[model samples]
Target: MEDPKRLEEGLGHENKDRNEQFSEKDDKTKGGDGINHEKEETNTVVVVEQKGDHKQLQQQPLVKQKTKRVATLDAFRGLTVALMILVDNAGEAYPRIDHSPWNGCTLADFVMPFFLFIVGVAIALAFKRIPKKRDAVKKIIIRTLKLLFWGILLQGGYSHAPGDLSYGVNMKFIRWCGILQRIALVYMFVALIETLIIKQRQSVVEPNHFTVFTAYQWQWIGGFVAFLIYMITTYALYVPDWSFDVYSHHKLERYMVKCGMRGHLGPACNAVGYVDREVWGINHLYQSPVWSRLKACTLSSPGSGPLREDAPSWCRAPFEPEGLLSTISAILSGTIGVHYGHVLIHFKDHSERLKQWVSMGFGLLIIAIILHFTDAIPINKQLYSFSYVCFTAGAAGIVFSGFYLLIDVWGLRTPFLFLEWIGMNAMLVYVMAAQGIFEGFINGWYYKSPDNTLVYWIQEHVFIKVWHSERLGTLLYVIFAQITFWAVVAGILHRLGIYWKL
Candidate 1:
């Protein structure tokens, strides 16, 4: 018998306990044979042996079991996490690698949604084959709390610096919600959807496609429902008295106007900002938002105002991009990942799988285009607009399809093993990144003046001097060097089997 409590390394339906069934069968046999029942329950495995003249019974301790893992899924998750580390580190130097300052999507804009999408995929991979609904719910609640706990305490959130904290500690500027917190939330809610609302079917050799819809159909239904709810909440449920026109910025005033959300409607007055402000309190939100930084929208021109005295020169307003309301659409992005996971599981034909991937990607992409062109929904990452959901989810589907084609279907996994290493220990690296432990380690190797570290010297001599622009060269060096640095770190951890998951 295998131990029931086993460590899961990678994603899949939490390995079904092979020993549970064996134990149950042995118990029934023991009960019929009039063997002691209480003894069987504790660290005991029954064994019957036959000698030349007599038969004997023996018991042994339970052993461990191995569960199935998906390598491609690991690749997907690793690729996303690695990129997150890359862009986050580089964004400090290169503005281009960072999120789009405002409404439009940039390379960095795709990272978060893609990460969410992978989470969705992970949920399906982890629980699709699970039959115990109660168990699924339990796992969801527990992991949600763990992630949320760390998210609140990590960097870019609470003021944990030794200098900032003294006496009672200054808690006024602490952030209430963040990236990990949002991932936890989306995972919990979406897991509930798959576990409770959409009941899992029994294992099957061939899962029948939604008979009516040739495609998996769950993807379509989930996407449409998520978007419908998001659209209605964002547009129809508008707060009033706050107009759409460009206005002013105040440290206290997140939205453009001084009237506040007595009642406001429009892009600026979306529920995403309102809920975060009311629920988390303005002080707890990110002091400077990604969108407001480098771009200014004010009373006169679109983003055409001087840096408000209340705010920093880069950004004065405290608007949480990963707000409570935005989580609504983020779930949709994750739903796309869940759909892809199902496609991987149920479909065997590589060509058919490829076709489905293409179909799903294009379908969503076209819809997003229509929404953007019609002006019915703009692709605003700040708001997590319906168009943005569609666009990003579509992009995620397409990117995953590429991985499916090159890695899973083709089985060219050797090159992607680097990413797999990172993927396997995604949470560990994520926490380290959030804590800035990676930066501290990098600094520890230097023994020169504060500004004359190995990285700085390389940037100065090899990058900035060789390249034309100081900022551009520095940016390029960070982008390349940081990703390589993190990849090596992730690789080392993976080699040591140090995969940390909740």
Candidate 2:
């Protein structure tokens, strides 16, 4: 049998030789492992084989370097980010493009989780390059802190407006947690376990003696344990202080109602607040008075209610998707992503098997069925319910696999370049959007002409007048607006080569 190491070394040498030839001449080469060159000096072409020990070549840095990023994965990530921006900025004109209120899924619901899954995939690729366990843990912690800080900043930090600090907290007041913050926390914990625990165990277990069940078996068990703990901690077991008193015959609902007179009714109803405050306490929920005061200053306005309302009714509360408990499930979703990344790495070129796709398809089917039938695990973003996590994960897996197949396997590329460009600079675009750089200009249209705001003009003229279909027209309008914004962003980033990294 031919040695795999020797073959890899020989391939690297051939690549190096080709590069050397190309540098020597001002021309380019084409084709596979063998090099065919055409010289600009003469219209002649030449083929050459440089003989050397492929084993020695294998030890070179080029041969031993990690795999190049698969473009399909980046494209998939870009598509996910684009969807996030569109859904986030749908401007109330297109309800269907928005996420489901509670206990349901929508096209918009899949975006954030897909980004999280991609984060897991990126983490898997990253850890391979950082060999030291302690060093990896330190790096993960630093990254997590940075993400948490940024999440808080985006949540409110640096003031909702410039030169405004009269609010309770510096800008981090509404510093409850967020999408990137959740991702950071999950990545930190997962990296710690994978490095300190899983890798250590694997090292002790000899490769030849290992079965899949024995070697990588801990991760599945760990996932289930985490899920079980989260469910029990969040739902099945409740703190006595927050529960109805059987002896006193006072229902919890009645208690909340009695307390409603203290400005606790309607939007101020503290049923959800009581649970988050009394049950989980401030540690997990992190609801400081300063944060509440900051929220009152920054988010108490008319149009911001829907987006800023954290604690609704108790029934609706846990389903907030971004709530404290739901984050546990989201962390588990990240674990699921990590496991999928492992499969991608270990299987590599063999991922095209019929069984693999079939298994993934079945996983998605099961999630869909559960999402349709089960009411206990609501598909609410606030609660981040187990069902919601499963549903989003399944959808994300399907999308990732599809992208991998199309871009990596089939070598197809096309109109997605704009998306790819923005994706490479996603954080920058998000921050820029948040800072009102584009919103300022977009909203400026409304200032000039009362009916000329982009959304208003589209609703009145494009949807109502030009097109008959309100929903479809409005949806298209949103897409057009998003694409226009993306084009501007892409042009700027392309010009400066300014890709933001965290």
Candidate 3:
């Protein structure tokens, strides 16, 4: 409840006023007309109102307590942010946890889907009761724009990475798509869909098995339509030979990749890559792709290394992982999340919620397994295939339910308090830690040389030197230095009631 509360409280600047208005409405509608207000039981308390010996027993509706924020949702979201920091920071030294080279699931590959899934779940709670549709639409648009602006600002190939002490991006080659950008697109469409279609909160004493499904049938249909479009475009599009130009030793060089193929899902020739190139342009796409680490491209196989002698021309070409088609497919994750949020809104009983969540979770997993094993979809994160959505969304549901069980149901919130803190202000942590804004700022302060910053010294002397293992040291640095430090910052912010929403 705390998790959804944080979102409802922080997501929009106007939510506070909106909540107050709802409270006022509740107060005014406390008589015969308001008897069936939003799932309220018919229990009433006697009020004594007397006027000169005429004793009258007036019954007042028992006001329901405000819904507390879901600690489980906060903890679960915080866990996702933590995993993002871990994988992004430590994956370079540990390839096992890194994103899959091409068409498999890895720890790192789950991060994006997990993020999308969280957004989906949050949308359900955020739009539980939309008092003013126009205002809600305006807020959604503003937030979506903010996400887009930040995504482009932070990840638009402008800001230098940790090691580089440089600023500014080459506008000509600035990447237009990234992790946040994809999230922005998904959030915009999903939030709009929910805002446009959601009915007013209705009282349901005992919602049948298909109540949630029936309520959100349009969202499901939209998801299916999007999925169908993705499938058709993926399988029917004719991909021809594509070429990209790059400067090699200050000389302009062009490389042509012969990919006159259709329905191919390899790293070289895929409909996703083709669509991105045709739409966003090759220069605007991500320069360094995970495909470069593929066995066919690199001699080192899993880790990025020198290109193999027989590497294909497409290996060097730019590819955007969070491309247009893949992002369209990603909307399904958010749709599934909305369904979970609906369950939370409708069902107050822990057992019933868990039953629905677990059932859906396992059901999605089963579909993912069937599609993957049958070689139909193959669970490709790069493509954001149908199977990938099912697998990741299912896992997200089960994991979220586990957190709900542990923290919300069982009242075990202490152990995961740090995660809850981070979840409460996830956007702040994401910008500071995951995006390396803090690192870049810290590196700005140096003694004599740019490389002599506190960040570099700590990574070299404190972590790597102590462990004598670069991989282990890198992992520990991320855990202790980045994750722990941000956790404390978020906790302080949470205590201070300071949150960076949007």
Q: Count the clashes in each prediction.
A: 8, 11, 7
lDDT at position 177, candidate 3: 92
Off by over 4 Å in 3: 1-46, 49-52, 56-67, 200-206
In model 2, the runs with Cα more than 4 Å from the true position are: 1-68, 157-173, 201-214, 239-275, 279-320, 350-354, 371-376, 434-437, 441-474, 491-496
TM-score of each: 0.74, 0.66, 0.89
After superposing all C-alphas onto the true structure, candidate 1 shows an RMSD in angstroms of: 9.0
lDDT of 2 by residue, 1-502 (tens): 0000100101112243332211112122211101111222222334344577432222222321222234554566667767776776563455455665444666677877887777665554334333455665666677678778877665534334212212345432244566777777777766566656634344222322123225556655666777776666655432332322111245433222123222121213323344455544433343322112223323532122332455322321221235455565677676766656555534423343223533664686587567658655556554566777777877777777777666555656566556556556666655655333454445455646644576566556865567777656756665666555665676576567445656
Which of the two, 1 or 2, has more lDDT?
A: 1
Query: Least accurate stretch of 10 residues (summed lDDT) in model 2?
Result: 1-10
After superposition, candidate 1 runs with Cα above 4 Å error? 1-69, 159-169, 197-202, 205-226, 240-267, 293-315, 441-469
RMSD of each: 9.0, 11.2, 6.3
lDDT of 3 by residue, 280-394 (tens): 8889998888889998899897997999889988888888999999999999998998888778767756788899999999999999999999998899998999999999999
lDDT of 1 by residue, 229-248 (tens): 76677655645433122235
User: Between which residue pairs do clashes occur in model 1?
Assistant: 239-263, 239-264, 240-263, 240-264, 241-263, 296-303, 297-303, 311-316
